[model samples]
Target chain A: MLWNLPGIHVPADPLYPGAPPFLTNTFLLTIVGSILIIALMLFVGRNPKQVPGKLQNLVEWVFEQFLNLCEQVAGPERGRKFFPWVLTIFLFVLFANWWEVIPGIETIGFKSTDTALSPACAHVGSQGFLLFGQYSNCITPFFRPPSTDLNFTIALSIVTVVMTQVYGFVVLGFRLQIGRYLVFNQGIMGFIVGLFELLLEAMRLISLSFRLFGNLFAGDVLLVVISFISIGVGAIPFYFLEIFVGFIQAFVFAFLTLLFFTLGTTPHGHEAHEEEHLAETAHAEHERVASALAGAKLEEAHAQ
Target chain B: MAEHEPHNTQNSRGGGSNPYQGALVAFSLVGQVGLMISLGALLGVFAGLFVDSKLHTTPIATIIGLLLGLAAGIYGVFRLISTFRKAG
Candidate 1:
């Protein structure tokens, strides 16, 4: 049945049994997604024009939207600094998620005939292509969505969290950044709060990784089950749903990264500055309102 | 009316009042809470198991770790909510 859950197989080294090797379906898909992004950027940016064509206009519009979002969330100055990273992350994840919806992604692969290889490969008479003398009931997909894999998402999360810390240190200096996780003063409550903050930081890595992995994996599994139950027709609506979900997930991931970037880059001392700024703005607003009310009263008297 | 105008202007300037942005923020917040709690507990159990194995005290450290994890998870939720509130 096509409804079997995706098996978590340790990718074997194609060369030797104990040889240190690399590259799995997830990695390959990631590489492909990256290449696609690079190609799209090159194609859209090849010609500089006063008025952009359709593809160039589309690409530019997307970038402009993301840039605006970053600026809105992170302020204009820091937004510009982090725009490229956010854009790259969004595009990569967007492509990686969307790639699963393409025809023959998880559906096409060779069957495992060698039962000795693994227990999953023990189904001898099952329907699958004969791949390296192995016959299994189900085919191992050539390209799985990268985000559906825990390893891929964890790697991405690690990089993101590490960058956040790096940016924090750069902006706040080593002492202040360390101070964020460790409190030496302010009594026991302060120390406890600091420990909780540290725990939250660790949890961020887990949350970030698992969120992407769970969403994509669930979607992929749902698609497979639907396709199995009703052939192809019933899965069509779900395919569209998955596309929307893919886009939303990509947006959320990128936006959160941008949010963290903003938070990390803000100095601890800026809280007081921000409060003062807000107070000044409020005072100005109050004066403006008072002046407007006075002007309205004067106009009313003149009319009377 | 005068008092409300500054808040309104500030909201408009912040640009986070849009429905799409709101939805994204809400989704992310939900995911954060769910994962924090579950992963926190799971990590705690594993850590406790490792410690218990080393010290030959099985359930004692495990129970303590689980409680600590639950506390941490609750703290995490509050922290996330406050952060979002501040941002908004």
Candidate 2:
């Protein structure tokens, strides 16, 4: 029996009729992902325990890990301030990427009625399933991961970049922050550099969004192609690779966001140099302690 | 424990709270370098195209925009490297 190869849609299909076209499968999945995160947070945070249960312990460990990351990268005060934003971004992105690995997500959907397919190859099932066909893609999957959609990634990137600007204003005040892009007193070279910086800020909106979107979208296509070539046999390793890729992409998004926040909040000129120096020293000290702890744990394990 | 010592120290050197964060930055950095450059050129061309449409200069603005965008992308990559250097 021939397996029906699914069609890849760059723009998400609307989940239902009579609604806005923007209410696509990707949009619904994003909302579902958000609600899941919220519910998990609420369930975990409902009661505080002196000694955490398994669920609470897992959540706390994740929280502490990110908290340490923030403090290490951004300095103590700024890191603490930026922690919530960094954590939220990480969790949201992580879920979105992981959803790609779920079995039926992009695979299970109704046969497309509108997409023009050759009558010779197209076989629509009794229940509207696109069954065993030479056609590559005839089914419109009910769910597509949010990262697979350019819109979702672009929206997230814009929010992150805008928040960086907001943080700049909050930390360095209006004059200093605005001065970053428009420097009159710094001479022609400085002026050009400032312009480049401004252009780079706009370019980040593209870079951040496209990076996540490209990686995940390509992964989806790869899976479909690989599965098509050799059926189930060749796709196993790629699925595992997708899981790893998913996590790394999520981590990169969050880490970059944290870095941008740090850059945004930092004051310019001599103060910038001084603050960086201090943050570096503190970060080094933290690393030393972490290394020492790791060594101790290793030694204890050896002794046992 | 002895075998793991190097791995643990390496994690610390990588500059994350865990090994996952430290090592993955290298992976992310490589991807970032390529993406930054392309995006820079792409943005430049788009802006150039817009200006050309407005002023009817055709490809002249587009060419200049491409050069400037490429340059901006290179500069952006430089900043990214320095930032990571400072970070790690």
Give me the candidate number with maximum TM-score. 2
lDDT of 2 by residue, A231-251 (tens): 868999999999999989998
lDDT of 2 by residue, B1-88 (tens): 4556554342344333666667776777787788879888988899999999999999999999999889888987887776657656
lDDT of 1 at A211: 80
Q: What C-alpha RMSD does candidate 1 show over the true interface residues after superposing them?
A: 3.6
User: Per-residue lDDT of A1-304 in model 1, one digit per residue for the tens?
Assistant: 3343334443321222233345667777889999999998987788768999888878887787777677666776777888999999999999989988999886665554444444556664454344322232345566778888778888888999899998888777898788767887767766776776677777878777778887888898888778766866999999999999999889888887887777666654345468769999999999999999999999999999
* Quality class of the docking in candidate 1, CAPRI style: acceptable
Q: How far in Å is the alpha carbon of A114 misplaced in model 2?
A: 2.4
The alpha-carbon lDDT assigned to residue A142 of candidate 1 equals 68
Off by over 4 Å in 1: A1-20, A114-138, A267-304, B1-18, B41-64
Which candidate has the top score in DockQ?
1
Q: Work out the TM-score per prediction.
A: 0.77, 0.81
